[model samples]
Target: MSTSSPSNAISGASSSPSSEDVETIRKNRVLSSKLYFDISDTMVPLIYSSSYDIAFFGLEKLHPFDSSKWGRICQFLIKDGILQQSQIVEPLEASNDDLLVVIKSIFRTLCQKLNLLPKRKTYFGNLNSSSNVSKIIEVPPIALLPHWLVRQKVLYPFRKQRGWAINVGGGFHHCCADKGGGFCVYADISLCITFAFMRLDISRVMIIDLDAHQGNGHEMDFGKDRRVYTLDMYNPDIYPFDFKARAYIDQSVKVKSATSTNVYLKKLDKALEVAGICFKPELIVYNAGTDILDGDPLGELKVSPDGVASRDEKVFRFAKEKNIPLVMLTSGGYMKSSAKVIADSLTNLSNKGLIDLATPPLGTFLCVHM
Candidate 1:
């Protein structure tokens, strides 16, 4: 069984919790737990993201939470002292391609490392048996275009914009071309974006990944396209263990060297400013990762929930204020405090202009509703 604490994920929020809000939080935890539990073990692949959450949130401390549901789901994958493994096979690999063999071998090795059983076949199953695999969800692409086009839409857009912003879970930046993790960075995002554009017959797009981890995959995915400008940020020394020795890259920003929300945001603000001054993108894709929150076990920066909230607000509002069409996605988030980010983001979007809530920041009060 895995063990991680909720407190370990967040140091503290900026304000005190009201008793009523506390009760609501208690109820939400119960609801979230139940929602996760009643789900099937077969759904593990579909919901591995939850395990990512478990790994990040410190499942043991999901107080007032009964983990039996997630526990059973996790353990089943470990039957016969082995967990199951899956891989995203390259679409272009030849039938007898050595790369395919290598990928299969790697899957076997990973299963062995995790003590997991190998389930043969490329995985493409529904998260739930009743669900339609054909209806699989996809991430859109990052849009890089000119400015006046951005002003025509709800989000900041470029002149005659024709791109989209895609989102996904975790900062899976390692899954890029050069990384040997076959497929392009932002592969999911790109595929979705391409399909959307083809279906819509639109052209031009740029991607922006704001996760705490460098958008390594996105960088590789769109490496050759001058039209695709990616901005990835993360600490180079930690996690992904493999890239630690590499020199500080100009392509992506390192949060570890300068660990503060102000610096990170300033860096991002600068990147966006440059993009605005140069690219003039029409469609903006924003990947809002919550792992940057201070005390996040997986995060290196110390941005507060409010800081994250501000980042989201600024990004979306800027786009909206600029009239840019945008598509937003939940990318990386290791901390349960991310729950607050999600709640507040939606609240910010929903309570875009309502006033007289009597609360200093309306976002804080919405957590209770979440």
Candidate 2:
């Protein structure tokens, strides 16, 4: 998330304001600017909390999923530290699915409680009995950047290189098609890739996923779409273990994160070297999730901030060197507040006059800049 204080424009001097007046105005402006960042990193816990489970709490106010499901899911989610205990929505009754129906009703009542009715309505409108179950929709077609645009001219290429990156999910890389070869409404990395490709069609598009998990989602989605390429850097025994897209996998820079940063960085460096040789992509979608952070509640590997920064800097610097447009999305990380902080670091890169918002990712990262 990104936010900035309003510019202290010195308009036609009302006889130049006193120094004290200018100082006072600056202080007020600093205090009033709103805070923005990837709120999902913060709001996810609130959405999963027990307080959110109350029929009355969400009734007319929030999503209308079966209340029972919320309890069932949140228990596992919270117990695993995917969410915080303090974040639970409260004042809910104890019962099974029947009470859940009431909870759904409560969602209608709670719309005003959360101040999200309009956004929900707009979100729902996009649904026509079709949408990803995860609700990660494809970037809209109208907003799609096609090859025509990139070919016509070059605008701030530096913005593409050093700008903030927003890498979404890569571990469960399920594409928009099912394993049985049927259509799945939600798995649309292809949609994202297509949009990027159409816009930067003249340039190679790189999907560099470093989730200790796999990119099964993208593999299925873009396996046949040659315009897109993948470098699945992960372990094979990890969750979502059925990943089989390695046949076409351009750079499978896999490694085990031993109890040493040196080993981890070595693996990451190998991945980068491979990526440089195979694709030299003009755009990169980096999934810099910190589940790899040492002692991560969910991840099996061990990685530290120093290691992560090394990995991040390599990508950012490489992209800068190649002048590649990058769109980094958060894929996954179970640690508390790790994703948001990682996002904040990336946003800082944006403020350095390197990143430009082609389209802001789902977070507060661009509100200040926008």
Candidate 3:
């Protein structure tokens, strides 16, 4: 966050703008943007794209975070007959101004200077070069940064439709308005909620971040914002130990390392109950991360594959019971097996009648192994 004022032209955001002026700019940018478009009822709210999968010449396999997990999850769903390629909605590539609708003006210029958002070269350059893999991995794949693009695709026609969507990628809760960390280069979660607030004519939103790492990014962005209610359930001792952001959490539930599945679910049930009493949100954003699975090195918790499915079902059920519009993002989870687990959870949700989209045949049960 630079010290520059609103008058500075994409130079910096060091100074704050008057609330009324800022809102006006945000609204204007959003209204003029081409990212938001109308979709027919025939297309499924499940958002994904083949470009989301990045093959770094086998370099991605070296990184703990499975970069291709987004495409893999969709592949499994398509293979199991839960979804067809034609039914899924492919999002438009988000442009510079599209991101500026939520982020500060300076970020776009900074990204350009760093060659991070290259115009001449590929959006994502070759990672085979020295230190390139580490550099590219630091910024999440381009697929994960399309939060605003997907939000409009889902929320624009929300009133006439199911009002729920699942972006096979995103939930970059570790990135905020000013900074990016934990492999998150842009604050897509913040951008999505901000766009929803500006364009959807909605005021209240609830973020249910179940990632193993604390969602310090959004917590920081919405710390004092009463309009947003955050319910983050993450491990205490994890990558980000931001005590300041932790204080802002409306509902903070901590599960220690090696915490069993049953105990974790019980806490979530109680948390959701309390949240229902505290705030009635117009929209819910669920960040379903599988990093908490038993064997993950980063998220030291002990949840199983089955437990992950149960966790997702509980969140979907909570939303269904309230009839609130919900959006789910695959936030984190490094291992190769994370994709399979996510696919299984989708099957569970569909079987439970949570989502109206495609499901397995009556007598057939589908389980995908990566």
Task: Report how far off residue 205 is in candidate 2 (Å).
Answer: 1.3
**Candidate order by TM-score, highest to lowest?**
3, 2, 1
Steric overlap count per candidate: 36, 49, 3
Q: What's the lDDT of the predicted structure labeled candidate 3?
A: 0.71
Pairing residues by index, what is the TM-score of model 2?
Answer: 0.49
- Runs off by more than 4 Å, candidate 2: 1-172, 178-185, 199-203, 257-259, 340-344, 347-370
TM-score head-to-head 1 vs 3, winner? 3
Index of the highest-TM-score prediction: 3
Error of 3 at 283 (Å): 0.1
Which lDDT value does model 2 have at 256? Answer: 61
lDDT of 1 by residue, 275-330 (tens): 66655555655666677788766666788777786777777766766676565555
- Model 1 CA deviation exceeding 4 Å by range: 1-173, 177-186, 241-251, 353-370
In candidate 3, what are the lDDT values of residues 1-370, reduced to their tens digit? Answer: 2222444433344433345555565676666655556555566677776666655445356557776798899889889888888777666665555555555543444445444454533222221132332342453342343444433332122111111378777777787766556766456777777777877777999999999999999898899999999999999988889899999999999999999999999999999999999999998989999998999988999999999999999999999999998889887898889999999899888888898557322332111000
Global lDDT of model 1: 0.41
Tell me the whole-model lDDT of each prediction, alpha carbons only: 0.41, 0.44, 0.71
- After best superposition, candidate 3 residue 88: deviation in angstroms? 0.8
Question: What is the TM-score of each predicted model, taking all chains together?
Answer: 0.48, 0.49, 0.78
